[model samples]
Target: MTIVLIGYMASGKTSVGKILAQKLNYKFIDLDDFIEEKEHATVKDIFKNKGEIYFRKVETQYLNELLALSNDNIVLSLGGGAPCFGNNMNEVLDSSTATSVYLKGSVPFLSNKLIKKKIKRPLIAHIETVEQMTEFVGKHLFERIPFYSKAEKHVLIDNKSKPEIAEAIIAQLF
Candidate 1:
């Protein structure tokens, strides 16, 4: 089965996914890294050079490609905005061989995490203050919760270590 991890930026999807995959003995694939490898460009450079529309298109294409893989034991972590665009969320939801988990994080919690790593995130890199980050995250999360809520499992990420979150996911799944 393909276990898809979906959540906002800095919500610990990639980090927790690594631990989850290790515990499950599954291959771990981060969608953004996959895109970077396939496109021969970093996600930051892709956004800077090709614009978000083009990036989203390629993102969907790669997402579909990954989802179509016949590999049974794989854990895939998606970009923050992946589910909110095109039919990506639907594709994941409709896949019989895939189970999705939403690493649900509150706006404040997510904003706090993003603020420290803002430079690494193209989407919120320009955000200057905690207030601005919180406001942006609040609005963004409001828009994304619908898509994220469609996940087969939901794991609250507040006040938990990555390993704890991963263990929670395993408990929920089994």
Candidate 2:
């Protein structure tokens, strides 16, 4: 079975996914990293050079490729905005062998985390203050929650360590 982790940026999808995969003996794949390796360019570079439309198109293609894998135990972490675009969330929901998990975090919790790593995030890279980050995250998360809520499982991530989050996911899955 494939376990797909979907959440806002910095909600620990990648970190918790690595731990979850290790514990489950599944291969771990971060969709952004996978795209970078396949395209020979970073996600930031793709956004900068090819623009978001191209990036979203390729992202959906790669996402479908990963979801179509048969008889593989995989832990896949999606980009923050992946579920919100196109029919990606429906595709994930429709996968027979895939289980989707939403890593849920509050606006304040996500904003604080995002503020520290805004430089690495293409969408909010220009956000310089906590207030701006909070506002941006609030609006974005509001719009994306409908898509994310379709996940098979929901895991609260605020104030939780990566190991704890992984264990929570394991409990939910098993």
Candidate 3:
């Protein structure tokens, strides 16, 4: 079945997903990359230009369409907040042959990893101080955990190598 990896920002979804896909010989799809490809812009740019609501609508539409076309062997890496909003979470649970996997990590781990990147992460970009970042990571991760915990499986990832984590997940699922 398709593997849907969901978690907070900087939680290694994309990295571990690629490794898993390679090991399993499946196609790897980052949901953000799919949206970006369709929009011809970065996710941050899409949010800035069309507003978050618009992008979310597009995302919902894409999710439905993808579900209709999915098979039992692709890897889908979802956005950090994708499963927590709207009815998308319920839809994911009901539709497709997708197995949801929550990549669990600590707030301190995420903060340390994301602090160095100046990328399309709009929410955490302005928090420059370590204290602010720590709080940001804590609050965001905490709020999202309730939703994330509903995934079919949970995997703790404590700064291990991507291949090791991928191997563990494959061993579990296969």
- Which lDDT values do the candidates have, in the order given? 0.94, 0.95, 0.83
TM-score attained by model 3: 0.93
| Candidate with best TM-score | 2
Number of the top-ranking candidate, with lDDT as the measure:
2
Q: Indicate the residue-level lDDT of 101 in model 3.
A: 88
Query: Residue by residue across 142-164, what tens digits does model 1's lDDT show?
Result: 99999999999999999899999
- What are the TM-scores, per candidate, against the unseen true structure? 0.95, 0.96, 0.93
- Per the 3 Å backbone cut-off, how many clashing residue pairs does candidate 3 have? 0
* Per-residue lDDT over 1-174 for candidate 2, one digit per residue giving the tens place of the 0 to 100 score: 999999998999999999999999999999999999999999889989999999999999999999999689999999888999999999999999899999999999999999999887767899999999999999988999999999999999999999999999999999
lDDT for each residue of candidate 3 in 62-134, tens digit (9 for 90 to 100):
7766666665578889898889878877777886587888888888877878887735576777878767788
